[model samples]
Target: MSAVLDKPRAKAKPKAAKSALQTRLDAIFSNLKLGQEKLQLAHQSVEMTDPGEAAEVLLRTVIEDMLPASIAPMRREPLARADVDAAYTGMFPALAAMEGVIALSIGQVIEATLREAFAHLDAANAWMDFTEMGDVLPHREDITEADRSDNDLAARQPAAAETENVAGCIFDAYERTIEAFAILDSRVSDMNSGAAYGARSLVKVAVDATSAADETNTRDNCEHASCALHEAIEVLTLVTDEAPDLAAEGALALLVLAKQLLDDNVGALP
Candidate 1:
């Protein structure tokens, strides 16, 4: 029995190397990848053949690929509005020299956008005026007159319609403005957040009001318009909050640009 045991039962054949599946799994794991050895650099050049197209791509990147929230720097601590005014005041000339007609055209479109923005304010005013009339009892004059009447919110309705046009123009302006920057081989990333928000606000008004007016009645249009204007106002206020340093400056710059394209004249609030 001791000799037989020592013989190891004729060498209990060396345990099978491994199951086929086990061998394959081990092979796969041996070559499996977990992490990159190094980060690859992105292309330095813009990919679009057209500069305008390139700009559209870049602006979208700004609008969509926002900096991580952890590092975003927008603030609202009462910065002087003058800072915005001053920034573009001096930068326009430099930009104009570098970007030429493209720059000027962007300014003009932006000017139009601003006026369109103002028009919405007027619409908001009209809507407010109409609503403020609030529950006045019909006078004895109502009994005497067969057809004496004033259209309710008539002025306000058209005011809202105007935003539809502005919305179209402002959307174009954003495209052109960034296109101009691309031509100059410059970046407008800093302005992207505020601009996108502001433009979207105005666009929301334009689209909401236009669609409702087209499909529904004037009263419905007014409701939509009012809501849109409120949203836009809030957006603009947020822009002021986020870009206090450049808000006034940007407005003033656009004003100068607008004046240049709109008319060659001067006026003051003395």
Candidate 2:
């Protein structure tokens, strides 16, 4: 007991501090995670609002608030040309913010993150043209029956079968895009190759293609959709070529499915 009491206790070692670079990286990742969460919340809010009500809600809650906060200051003083240019440039951040929200919403749709099928329904609405089709015939009470008939035909909504086909192509492409992103996200550490940014570039291409697909689908532009989906497939091919390990069998299968859908529907008018 006396010998044990005489033994000295070892001092605890101090924890090593994180390097400045590592600390910055940590902060960046944390901010990115927070940003993602915020985007998700905004997407949810958009989804919860009815399509008819969305415009009103957005105007009241977002645009109205922003206009006062951002533009009210300028109204207090007569703006010089320089001030006007500065204000114009400053609006870009708001534009970018809107674009980010829209992108995230589209991405979530592609990922099938939303529980409802309303997203697909909304996409399908693109094929339903509400406007009168064909050139505005001369506004005359003496319009011929043939002209009216042609106008009615031109204004007709797309054939259900055709709409379904295009929708299937878009859906398949979106699903594959989601898979592609999943693979890239898993291998984010390899996004940058020593000096080449092949993976990162392909990722951008994939995102752009998905966005194009969404926009074209909304416009019922099948040709553009086909091209976009083709680009998406090309991205998958690039991903496979650059990092075969990341191109899992499931992803390849989805790619094949997407390609088949596109092939079947290519050249078909919306």
Candidate 3:
């Protein structure tokens, strides 16, 4: 009887260990950490020195945020070509221009502007990533196909519908960010063109205004033009604010960036 009791006790320890492993596996399967991980990865990816690295990170983030949880269960694509094309179109040009400016500019002013622009881009990307992730987590398969499938499916089954809606909102935010970047790029181009004819040096830029009235006009026009870039950024900021899933730190990063660019350019105006 003692021998049998000892054998059962030894077997019980193995069963307990097996049960613990199963419990851990269940916890992992039910975990909601994917969303957190996606955002964190997006943040880190943006910090990379290489533009290619940054771009890869951005692309991976978008895919991760958009992908459904159970790939084997649902055979649908995560993102449409049109949506992917639009997103790339919006971000790539500005990203390239930022890289160019970083290479070209020698002084502190350019460095500061470059820093601000990248910071804003990173923030905007992170916010979008978060919002998109909010959409398709719990009922991952059904929620992601919301745009493609019937409204009845989405409306009748409301498990992850809110998450899908949040994803849509995130897409909209990125669109607005694209618009803001366009505005900034165009404005900067105009400024460079204007500068080409106006003055070569800071002293010359300042001295170009012969009288107080001339100085006022030059400052007013250039400053307003430069400030308009920030106005666009402010509108983008508002769009981000409208998103319920927006990260607060990400939003603040954008504001800090916009203010820095506006102040730098406006201050440089003669």
Candidate 4:
């Protein structure tokens, strides 16, 4: 009778369902990880003999496959404030790597792919709560450090001129402008504001102009790139006015160098 008096076992608690935002964040992080792995594999196995095609394939994978897949869930549920910074930071390495590849690869096809990718990224930014994210410059620094570390092996080899060509210059300028934009975007309480959208549109135009310049090594294209980059600088000034910081200053300086390189090369061109 005493043995039969053993207390009944407590019912197990049901697991709490993950919030939509958490689910979306998990999807994004998973896709990014998978995309990075694919990128690494492509880097190792794919021959650079056909760099243009290789670049196109890689860009397509990120833009069409990875990016869309990641952002699709976020469209349904806004990303949590705590998750936004990590999302952006996680995406940067892949996008930055693709940018470098795009700079190196000579072709017209990659331009459309890049524009599409940027558009997706811009849309994803709409889902983020930048106000709660606070300062994102440190995330940029993390990206820079990762970049430097990744290039450590390459640093042992002969140095490549970063702004050797007009396309390279445009990409360099684009990179700076985007970096500054990220700082501004993070600081802004409302990314959906007209001013923020305008700044983003300017950056998109700059990207389109850069793609145009990259498509063909022509004086006209170079001039277009110069003008677009200049507009980007003006936008950057607005960004700096909104949020003055070292990152913005540094971006402005580098953007000037990129523009100068484009101008010098354009002038030298017949």
State each model's CA lDDT, in order. 0.31, 0.41, 0.35, 0.49
In terms of TM-score, how similar is model 4 to the real structure?
0.34
How do the candidates rank by lDDT, highest first? Answer: 4, 2, 3, 1
Model 1: residues >4 Å from true position, as ranges?
Answer: 1-190, 198-202, 244-270
Clashing pairs in 1: 84-245, 84-246, 84-249, 85-248, 85-249
Which has the better lDDT: candidate 2, or candidate 3? 2
lDDT of 2 by residue, 235-258 (tens): 555655665432222233344444
Residue pairs whose backbone atoms clash in candidate 3: 135-163, 135-164
What RMSD, rounded to one decimal, does every model reach? 27.1, 26.8, 16.9, 15.3
By lDDT, the better pick of 1 and 3 is 3
Of 1 and 4, the candidate ahead on lDDT is 4
Give the clashing residue pairs of candidate 2, or none.
none
Off by over 4 Å in 2: 1-165, 190-197, 218-222, 228-243, 246-252
- Cα deviation of 177 in candidate 1 (Å)? 18
Q: Is candidate 1 or candidate 3 better by TM-score?
A: 1
TM-score of 1: 0.23
lDDT of 1 at 254: 27
lDDT of 1: 0.31
Name model 3 segments beyond 4 Å from true. Answer: 1-221, 244-256
Tens-digit lDDT track for model 4 on 191-228? 34555556556755766665666567578887887898
Query: Compared with the true structure, what per-residue lDDT tens digits does model 3 show for residues 1-270?
Result: 688766754334544345543343243323323433443444344445433332333333333322222111222234333332343334433343344333333253335544554455544333323233333233334434555465334333543442344323323333323322323333333334433222122212222222221234344643443344344434434443453111211222323333333343344345
For residues 1-270, write the lDDT of model 1, one tens digit per residue. Answer: 688667755545677788553453243223111100000001112223233443233322222221111011111112112221232233333222212222222443333332332233223222222123333323323422332322224323543553445333333333323332232223224456746444444644444453543344344443454455445435544554665423322322222232121111111101
